[model samples]
Target: MTTATTGDTTPTPRSRLLPQGVGVIADVAAVAALLAGGGRPIVWAGSLGAVLAGSYLLVRRLGQPVDRTAVVGLVVAVVGAGIFGYALRPSPPAGPAQQTTATPHSTDPTAGSPTPGATTNSTAPGATAGSPTPGASAADTPAETWLADVAAVDGGEGWRHGAATVAGTEHPRSVIGSTCSSTHDGHESFNLARRYSRFRSTIGMPDDAPNDAHTRFRVLVDRKVLFQQDLRLGQTATVDVGVRNGLRLTLEVDSIGTTSCGDTAVWGGAVLRR
Candidate 1:
């Protein structure tokens, strides 16, 4: 008697594709859905579920004529597999970080410290509002410091009394000079007070001194130009500048004399509110 040995064979490529077609379709559809309108998080979730179900259905069809019990078991297995795959995908990129740094500040009027971008100060009582804190660098002071310094000066037009030394101008003057100040006068509900100066050419012969006979002036705040004008002999003009909540101000006397002469200038003292 002769005996023959037999064993079950694995699925051929064509046979395997038949059972996996639904899964392939599901994966394609899911990716397409993501590419099209998956920006909303819910879309990804729903698509994943649908795709996994389709995969299971394709597999079940290959084993058709199964009993109810087998169908139930297949459904359970598909659900478990889908959940595992979803949990395993790599997470998306994170969003930009938010600013969490708290600003440092001092409370004394004269107790301010200079920081990179802005001045840090606290409005503590009786802190010598006019004096700049030790931390203030000549260059790093804020606009309010300029305003306060200007107010302390003896110019008729407040901080605007500095002289302008612009070249080529016949009557250059320092209306406010180089000063800093702050003010709260003539202000409405809004913080709209101004600190400015009025300068006239020195009323003497062109003594070869600065502003001997020049006739021009400029107004500035924090080194920012607010107004500039050329003056005629014996003529007087005025400018009105607007200030916000802060009193920081800057007034400067730019290069003076005609273009032929090299630039020469003078700056003034600090001014604050009256």
Candidate 2:
């Protein structure tokens, strides 16, 4: 008995994908969007969709005799990848930086002032001014006056060790840091007089400061210690000097351990407030 067999012509798993033409449209759109300087959303969506569609087309048509969709899709993916990488590359480091924010002041005619001859200013949200008393919290600034920045005050002295103002674009307060040698030991002073109320500052090391920086930062109000402690990189110690004792403010920096190897100290920014 002789058996005759017929050939089977069923499509295999690895055969050309059904939506061959869809990939072409996706690739073109993605490349066009990328080349047109499109923003993140459009570029990302286009590129991602193009990559998946293009890859599927390329793989399915790998052994096909003559199909331009696979090659074109592959090119679009590569080009899209290159464009995406370039567009998302990190920006260069910014130059020597300075950043500061304004202390929003209230605009009420009947608002109370800090002191008789002293001016006042509004603070961040939730600030209320109270009448001056024997023990007034710096937080209880009066509504009528504007609090002045430390650098803007008069008789501010004693950054003998070395002082520099760093304005942080995003920080609420400007940063006043030291530019002194490793073994720095000195006092910086600011006289608020009767013009300002809340006198305060924070002791900290600058961002990206050396690991070996060791500092004993101190804040003194009228010869009385408000805050005194050791400060390290990325550590913040706050000092609050009320307007009742707002006559004077001083900053003391001393390297405690390791001889101040990277002892760069910062104490005040918007130091005097209301």
Candidate 3:
């Protein structure tokens, strides 16, 4: 005659540290964008929403009222959820099945074997009976190579993001430039008059600063002023620019070479050929 059991105690609501303060500012802006060099993939996915809002505020503060920096930000949200569970782990599972190595032929063609169409388009080494196949010439036919090397094209100087590739020094293509700005003068305006006016290279400080500091290399076409110079530090100035037909070219460098982001202007070997 006894049937009345209902122990319904219930009590679990507490989780709101505002997702542990937005997952500790998205895990410190994804560890400062992974120490600066990585792009912010939405701040590394906000460090997994700050480790699921610090595991729902550490299970609503287990024994209650927590705060030693909220238990060191819930141990940096469980070490950023085990380092994003091994940095987003996943790959490895497509196609993958390639391993080949097979070679062993000798069907005894008359023992010393030597008669499969007698092999000969007169293969090299003094190719007899009339030689001269090494590229068979229009005189080897390959000479107009520098058709364009302006920082390798598309309006070159690497579209300027602090453009600087003065390699082996003494700048040639060694200069694609920018100096951030300071009244201005680091230029590169383009358009070599299409009809293909020549343009070798060299303009300022590189070939290892043969000179440094005077900065003032100019050149204009449609607007007139052909080529101007003033380089100095260690000295550099061999930009042979030639123009003829319907054109428009202007290149100036003079952010002044010292400050104003050290302009150092370049075009060192910025070619444009026939």
Candidate 4:
């Protein structure tokens, strides 16, 4: 008598369960990686999945047993793929950084107030004369006074004292200087008390001035002319006059022709340096 053997070596349900669960988890992770900007993570996940699947098929074809070791490897691979996908995920764009600036404290009690005897017929609303320009630092320069700060004693005809625009540039401290006619000149006088050494300014026509606008600017110390220039539209002059030991400072603007139509002069950044 002889004994016969059967070749029914199918894997048990318990043995297949772990690998199937791990495979499902890997597929889910790959889908997630694809949804979250599929770049290197998708490629890595697909490659690992293909390798593990191929190994499983090869083992099956060779009639080898699907053991606990194989299931553990599948679990490890899935876990690693998940970690890699998470690591390689795209990040959000960074926002602009916030900035903080501190304003310097002023030592002079009267720093922002208008100087005594400084007068203007009309001032722009919220105008502060004799004050340092916005963003100006007291420690940056010597003690100084702006011509726009002092009140005019003799004349301010057609002159508006405050911040104004000239040649498309904004002057934080300036005077809109103008004149009515060639004969009747517009002027502004300040009692300097012989305190300042130099007067400095940039003179130009407003950007909106007519093309034919023409005028002459004069700086006088104690009724004596120090600097004079004729300017037309788009022309600018830098005035630097020595006013040491001078009692009065005057700025005058007159028309070049008969009438001063469309003449909008700007005395920009006019200041006296000590």
| Candidate maximizing TM-score | 4
Ranking by TM-score: 4, 2, 1, 3
Candidate 2 lDDT (Cα, whole model)?
0.55
Model 1 lDDT per residue over 1-274, tens place: 8888677677654444333444544554454455444454554554565555555654656667765434543554455355446545686666556545676565567865654565434332223344444444434333333222223322333223333433233432232231111321111011113321221123211223434334345554444566565543233444445433333343333323443232222332222321
The digit string of per-residue lDDT tens for model 4 on 1-274 reads 7878878898765546456646655665565566557466556666556446545534553544656645555554555555556656676565555444575555586788655544433344235445433443334323566677767778776677777777778887787776775433488788766566899889988778777888889999998999999998888889998898887888888778864465767899898776
Cα lDDT for residue 173, model 1? Answer: 25
Comparing 2 and 3 on lDDT, the stronger one: 2
Question: Over 4 Å off in model 3, which ranges?
Answer: 1-165, 171-180, 188-191, 197-246, 250-260
Query: Cα RMSD for candidate 2?
Result: 24.6
Against the unseen true structure, what C-alpha lDDT does each candidate score? 0.39, 0.55, 0.52, 0.69
How many angstroms is residue 151 displaced in model 4 relative to the true structure, after the best TM-score fit?
Answer: 0.7
lDDT, residue 60, model 3: 62
lDDT of 3 by residue, 75-167 (tens): 757766765664566743656455444645555756676556343332321122221223343332122222222221123342342223454
Q: What TM-score does each of the candidates earn?
A: 0.25, 0.38, 0.20, 0.48
